[model samples]
Target: MSSRPKAKPHFRVSPAVLGPLGIEQLQDPALAVLELIKNSWDADAKRVKIVVDQRKAPGKILVNDDGHGMALAEFKERWLVIGASYKRALEKSEGGRPLIGEKGLGRLASFALGNTITIQSARESGRSFLADVNWEELSSAASLEEYEVKIRRGAVTNGTRVEIHDLKGAWSSDHTEFLVAHAEFLASVPGERFHISFKVDGKAYRVKHALATINRLAEGSLEMRVAPDGTPTIRKCVINGADEKRIVFRDMKSDELDPTLAGTRLSLKFFRRDEAARRLSGVLQRNEVTEVLERYQGIRVFRDGINVPPYGLNRDDWAGLEQQRTSTGGPTLVPGNSQLVGELHVSKRAQPHLVITAGRSGFADQAAVNALAKYVRWTVRALGTARRAEHLGISEANVRVPARIDEGKDRPRTASPQTIRAALTAISRSEVVRANPALRKKLEDASQAITETLGQSEESLRLYAQLASTGIAATSFSHELRAEFDVVSEAIAEVAASSRKPDKELIDLLSTSWGRILAFAALFKVVPVKIRRHRKTMSVSELRSSAETILGLASPDKVTTELTIPAMRLSIVPAEVDSILLNLVSNSVKAVAESTNRESGRIRVRFEAHGNDLAIHVADNGCGISRSVAQIMFEPLEGKFAEGTGMGLPIVRYIAERYKGAAAIVRPPASGFATEFVVTLRNVVQ
Candidate 1:
């Protein structure tokens, strides 16, 4: 190698480099305007006004701000320098506001909006100055330094004004509306000291903070705080004007979490977009509320009372809420972006690791960002859990009725005319009633009438319960028998194909299928009668055996079953338990079979006992239930699949309620399973 003395050469930048560094760096014209506003904010501006005039060709836009304007020398040193980092060393402005613009490139954002820019500023105690720049001239120059900005003396003023001409795009009403909407949210909090006004063609556009309006009508509100150690605790949760119990999340102490996510506070307000919720809001029109939510429903991050761009914008799922809800099959158990408006508060000086991206669109991809997302998700989930519990409590309270008195008996008894008459007669003998004989007679007559009405109601309730039970049983039996019949039919068809003698495998398959049919028939026979008898306790192994038998008949050969039963006995009747398992497994089988891309089906059954309550979770890797379907899946004849009788889940729910428990579609466990159903049986574990 003939290596002479290597020459060190410096790279030369072309005037065309401004295209990529300035004009092309920002794609959206509105964002360019936003960058200018941010510069005003960093200058500690209290009032800024933007005027867009399109009455003539090549519209002119003016941005005026009343702030601490720059002196000529200061402007030449900072504003003229490309890629300046002076703001990087400063934490706050002279007015004690946190600095927002640091890269010094935001000034170039004006070139994205127009071809020419004129800036005029006057400092309180320094000389006023004016600077004019033509972007087209700069881009065509031989070198970046060959272009010169014309600087001259300007009228004395206390603030700055930027005049941009030769607009790139036609200005319209929609652009003004976008400015109003986005500018309203820039302050992080509504009605802050920083004020922004917009005027289009001499018409002032009013800025309404939609988030503030929605917050007042929110159905629920939650506030949480995260400690430096990564422990999160709910400070307050109010749902439907009632304070809910607090929820706590485990500490996140990973290497990427603890250092960056300390001392963050989050506040969220929930709005349910439904007619009932709208009626409760009292003043909200359906269309008006919908429009508001569509615009402002997301979680935003704020650093020192100023919003970080693009985090809470429309359709921005920075926290992965939609992904979480889809993975868990839990729209009710997890809140999506459209359901909440939240604010996350962080400090620039405190959490420097949470750096903003180069384009100012969002936070950089870092561990700190992941930690923040995780904490926000946890907060949202806690809110959902509290709201769900509140709903369940309300449902239970609505269905409960006061106990009726019986003749000299402390226990509650069924309503009857004789019992009512006896109780009213005792009341009539009181001194106040004796004094008013006519009133006493009225009371006695009313009691008899009330008792008769209640008795009819009770009879109707009994009939309804019987009908529901019978329907569930019939549906379950049909589902199981169909599977067995299919197995038997397949075995017989195989035997017929041999044409010589029945193979051993085919004979064994037919016998097993027959045995399953008999077992299922016996199980069905005991369902209605065994519910009335004293419940017999069964060991964990016995329950597993029952589940295995049902799974074997319900699942096809390609389907696999996973059981995670703890070593505990349950004080539940075997028949009732069998019915619950039979319906759940059969539904899973159908769901798996209905899936378009079926390889090998998987079903998981897990049991956990908390005190005397047993929680059974049945999950499957199948064609998952949609949120709309899950909402009404427990209702009779409301199934998503065509072959579903829709009575299976209703039956499972009915049996659980008989034992003073509940059945629900819960968030799927984190085992890659979809569509999970939870059946809770109270006082059943021993």
Candidate 2:
């Protein structure tokens, strides 16, 4: 009997896989072109040129590079194979250039911009190969073998050229401009790295490299280095004459007041509008300054001198500068994202787990990335604070008290602190010792009274600011108190019904609601605490319990509370401690109450010894404060939330300061908690 040979089984790929759908992975046409340029860069090409001719219905795009090209065997195995990565084998080129290509998908990006792609490459051996992919023809084929890629071998010079025609769509002038700009930015490295030039319809388009150095023009700067263990050391530098001098200040580590910063290096430069204007006056024209400010204004991430996507985009608020400035009413002096520019450098060796997302949209959404973003936002706010402080100093120096000293008519206004101090010295030396003595006595009494008044004025202003913040919070707290009472009233009705019916569950509910009412009542007690009259050494455990007690009383079973306080004591006023706990816990409880998520809400209080200070964290699994809101939330009457009086934080701040401590909002650990405010105070034993 004769038997036919059995058909052998093998993998088959449909031609449709190489059609337009194949290039869909690249979202933007400009990005497709960029991918090609990047490939040329990875190829160690010293000179790369891209030209676009769009005068016809279907334009022609050509990219030529002088780089060592591919051989026939390499082309068949790596070039034609999708996802083949030669970069994985050789991390660097023969010329020692770090390879930027991986995943082996960049070559396919050509299909995104054109229907037909033709490539001709020659290696150092003088052997050349030509290959072309007509996606339209490939789409008609049933399998990969149905349409064969024609290959020719010949002797040619060493280089590579890619020609794309039968364009998928019309390339607008905007696209051309973007290509030119993108080419300039991508090739912003030293000339030794690569030289990339662009042309449109034979007209050479040069990118005006007018990007101003933010450090050179910055009025204030903040440089910080975060260790792998999250320890952050920051320096606040102010631009003085011919040099930037580091300004000495305590409490620089408070980015939301964190004790440590992990895994990032942030350098920020802030230019007040006027300072920017002055610096750019000689280098850039008035219109150019405006344009530069508009073009570059946000914190951008750079990995090995190349910018990562999305961070520097106009809409990206990687740093919450704009909102903080707007909400705080310091638009002129408070540098927003538009008035600030800086870089956050991350290394693959350092941040090994910080991976980029597919299509380079942004970093992969994960805990590390979120923390990085939070820290960056904090850095921006810190720089803004520094700038505002400098501005205030300038304004104070320029302020004129207009004192007549010995009542010798109107004198010229002193424009500087030194001048005013000198005038005061002269008044005391010459005017005060006159025989008449009346003017001297008058000046002496007036100076003494003014000094006392100034001291009183400072205290009064602080009190007023605190009161205003408290009043705003009172509005919200009052509403919350009333709501709790409403629940209590409903519970009373339930209890009455239960009394008649003898139902245990209704009685329990009534009891729980009553406890909540008492908790809400306890909150009011802290509000009236105007002085630290009740001073004592309190245990961290005691502090947590007090806060938990208030929360338990106010909300009952509406939210769960956890306390992880260490066995530590701090010398402070019991009432002041109560205020801090009450404000933070109440805020946490309100946050959880507002969440629409059906999951149970939680508040966590933890305390630990941090160096010579005691650190307490009041965290909650609720809608967290945004970067912007957190910046100014401590300001009197600054918060815009429904249940927030904005007074709680101010009071907390006041109490912290009174005890030689600080209060700051920190990025919460990823325990599903949204808000974490940390209070750091001296670990004084009494």
Clashes in each model (backbone N, CA, C under 3 Å)?
Answer: 0, 10
lDDT of 2 by residue, 220-333 (tens): 667777755565556445533222223322243544433233546787766643345444434335346645554556777765455676676442555444444433332224
Go through the candidates in order and give the C-alpha RMSD of each one to the true structure: 21.8, 21.3
Residues forming the 10-long window of minimal summed lDDT in candidate 1: 398-407
Off by over 4 Å in 2: 1-10, 18-22, 89-91, 190-192, 208-215, 235-263, 273-275, 278-284, 331-334, 388-686
The top-ranked prediction according to TM-score is 1
Superposition error at 613 for model 2 (Å)? 57
Candidate 1: segments with Cα more than 4 A from true spot: 1-13, 125-127, 172-174, 188-191, 245-257, 275-287, 326-333, 392-686
lDDT of 2: 0.60
